[model samples]
Target: MEDRDWLILKTIYEEKNMSKAAQVLHVSQPALTYRLQQLETEFNTKIVHRSNKGVEFTGQGEYLAKYAVDMLNKLRMTKEIVESMENKVQGTLRLGVSRNFARYNLPPLLSNFLTKYPDIKFHLITGFSSEITDLVYKEEFHIGIIRGNNNWKEQKLLLAQEPVCIVSKSEIDSNSLPALPRIHYETEPSLQSVINNWWEENFTQPPFITMRVDRIDTCKEMVKNGLGYAIVPKACLTEDDILYQINLTTRDQKEILRDTWVIYRNSSLELTMIRAFIDFIKSIKQEGV
Candidate 1:
């Protein structure tokens, strides 16, 4: 089938509703229906079945959608490689970045990188480090910027390391932390495990968790209001936050540092845009916590 037909099937598969797929494709519903009918007729199979709930893909439809995804990816990769052959570094750069790094570091990093290579276009997806790593492994991203120690077996560069600290409205004794009211926030499982293990090693008593929140910033606000204390990475705190922050250390006295890494398959460096961006990443000097 043609690229247009492939895209049609893919979009319908993603959107799951005829009307939603049509809107995304920027085509009329009737036209979309006609196109799908033509595709099904050419294949001589029932591709998708529509019911009152939504559209459901048949076995053939599922196979076609998977084929469409692979073909689209191959075509996109070919375009990137061809665009990179020129002297000008201009091509689409797909990236998957961790949430904290995307929030604190990526904007300025991308701004400067774009200034140097004005023709380069960026497609960035921000998520948990674990999710980013999975996307990278699936070849959905040219590069991934992630946090903690992700087990990426290919090219990996340590971007920065920031201290993990406890913040509160007022200074509290380090030994008193377990007895203090703790503001708990959800974080990636890897990092959460690290924090939990550290707590277990350092204290005999459990933390007196007073409240639970979904985000680090929400935990910070709770701390600012003198509600409780939170343990967060240095990236979450600012100089003007007006809070007391105590850096954590290992039992042997080394600071507990949270690491950020840039990960990619080595083959990606063959592209001019990817190569240039990696070189640029190497040159930047990130200030420490």
Candidate 2:
């Protein structure tokens, strides 16, 4: 099949619905259906089936979809290579970033980068650090920015190391932390584990959690309103917030730090765009942003 056919299969697999795939592919529903029928006929088997949820791919369809994804990635790489031969650093930079970073840090960083390399396009996906790391590992993204550590063998660079702290609306005794109202927010599992471990190390009793929120910003607002205290990375704090902040430390008296990392496969650096982008990020860190 042609590259267009591969793209159609890949889009169908990703969208999981004929109409949605049609919209993404910028084709009519009838045209997409005809294309799928043609693919099925060419393969001499049913490619997909309708389900209550949406379209479900058969085993053969799944295999073809995987192949289609590989083909698309290779095609993209080839194009990038050809373009780079002319000494141009321009291409789509697919990046997966943590939600917190996306909300707070990414805008300025992207603004500066895009200003410098106007030809470079960005496709950003934001989620939990764990989810972003998975996307990077799956080669779905050329780069990933995540909070916390990874056990993967891919190349990783430390972007920043900020302290985790006890934040509250009013001054609270660190010695009596377990007795006070605690505000917990759902975050990356690794971060939560670090906070839990720190708590377990210092206190015999569990925290008196007053509220549980889904977002870090919400947790910060709750603490700012005198609701409770939360243990979060320092990225949540700003100079404008007049909150009581107590930096955390381990039992051995080392600072409790939260790290943000830039991760990518070494092989991906072959693309001039990715290489330039990585260098740009490193330069920003060097300039102490």
Candidate 3:
């Protein structure tokens, strides 16, 4: 019912125990318990079920938790907006990025943003595109830059397009399909299925299978060592000397060209910081850099 009660509920959800939540909130245990009891009495239902180990949210608690999070986010955004009007842009910005972008794309963006706003702190979470998308929807991230897929929401920007490349060692002759290793990235099903379909259409038969890994860096490393031929984004390849590109003509070779996007929810755009960030991205493009 009150902000303090919601805060207590959030803390309990995080800490999972009354004593721990009280300690985290810098309040007496009895006071925290009383507040939670008051909330339960006001709602006429048990919000949380206490146990020896920790607390578990009841059905009512779960429903209220969602409302609490939405309320807290709105409150925080309101505070941030008011503060920004006073010429201060200082708050935490959570970002969700794929493992691919974390390596290839994040450095420059992070460097420039941090240099420009030294006071603003950042928390970067890296996972696959599917995981990042889920996080973005859950409000875990203010914005996410992810690889474009049909399943993603419509609100996204075409940031950059990097072609899919097949790389192998120079020593291997291209006259005949060598019995070399074949490396595949163990990414989300959407992209992985696309890769499989493209590989089948492009190659006469599957090449010798050596490894399947999650990260593009591993694929790149294996390719450099002549472990196998790998299909990956051109962005991952930094060295021009060790690896040789084996251009392929697949049915969806045109579609293999991956376009990166910046995605955010409609509600997130209402926040000044989020809007400024999107505007900054637009400004960067306008500068042609």
Candidate 4:
């Protein structure tokens, strides 16, 4: 059936009368009746039960009406998105981000992005790098900002690779502390394995973990409270007085560390807005920052 048929069905469902539905639609009663007849022919089911007082949907019509509403809503959204993309105008972008990037980096960039695309809306979700990457791979998110190197074979833009440092309270003597309590994160499997291997190679005794966490922000907080010490990307740090980095006389040459990346489906590389954002990220040299 045509779109006009759904509109007629919707109007009839709302107005509950042939004359009123036609009046509201600014169409003749006979035209509305013909449209409904065509839909009923298409579906091979009765859709309306007419009474002297008004009209109501039959069981089949009720079901079709519900589907019509949903289809219409989706159609409108699709039209808006397509038109906006074509016109270089506005649209909604669903984003999946690692929890750390969502907390540390997205604030200013989002602020600027919103200013530029005022009609655009964002749906944001935060999780681990792997979790966000899975969503991107599944096409659940149009774009993703995730921590650690991407191994998904998708194209990615490196956002920032700030210095990764160990943080702890002043009370924890960096030089003399015996088997310091290191905070651990559960998100990055590759990085976690690397950290474990680095710890094993560098020290005869392994540093004990005071606590394990799912998010780096919490790990930072735990370190600040002297609950433990954590190694995290330096972009998470502010020049504020609340947190400090641990001093190390000797560095482990084998440690692997870095920050997050912006990734999208390989097919999306041709989209203008996506390319624009990638260029903006590189122009800022976010990796160097």
What TM-score do all the candidates reach, one by one? Answer: 0.94, 0.94, 0.78, 0.63
**Global lDDT scores for all candidate models:** 0.89, 0.90, 0.75, 0.73
Lowest summed lDDT window (length 10), candidate 1: 280-289
Clashing pairs in 1: none
Clashes of each: 0, 0, 0, 0
Model 2 quality (TM-score): 0.94
Give the residue spans of candidate 2 off by over 4 A: none
Q: Any runs in candidate 3 off by more than 4 Å, and if so which?
A: 1-4, 11-42, 50-55, 87-90, 138-140, 151-154, 171-179, 203-207, 252-255
Q: For candidate 2, which ten residues in a row score worst on lDDT?
A: 79-88
Tell me which residue pairs clash in candidate 4: none
Query: What is the lDDT, from 0 to 100, of the residue 179 in candidate 3?
Result: 70
Please give the lDDT score at residue 54 for candidate 3: 89
Instruction: Give lDDT: candidate 4, residue 40.
Output: 91
Q: What lDDT tens digits, residue by residue, belong to model 2 across residues 123-240?
A: 9999998888888887878899999877868798889989999998999999999889998898889899999999899999999998999998999998889999999889868787
lDDT of 3 at 121: 77
lDDT for each residue of candidate 4 in 1-289, tens digit (9 for 90 to 100): 6777777778788889999999999999998888888889999999998899998899999999877766775575466456656757356677898876787789888887777667667789998888889878866567888877668687887777656666877655654333777888765675565556555655767677778888777777787788877866677787663766652222544335565788888755545555656666776674454
Candidate 3, residue 132: how far the Cα is off, in Å = 2.7
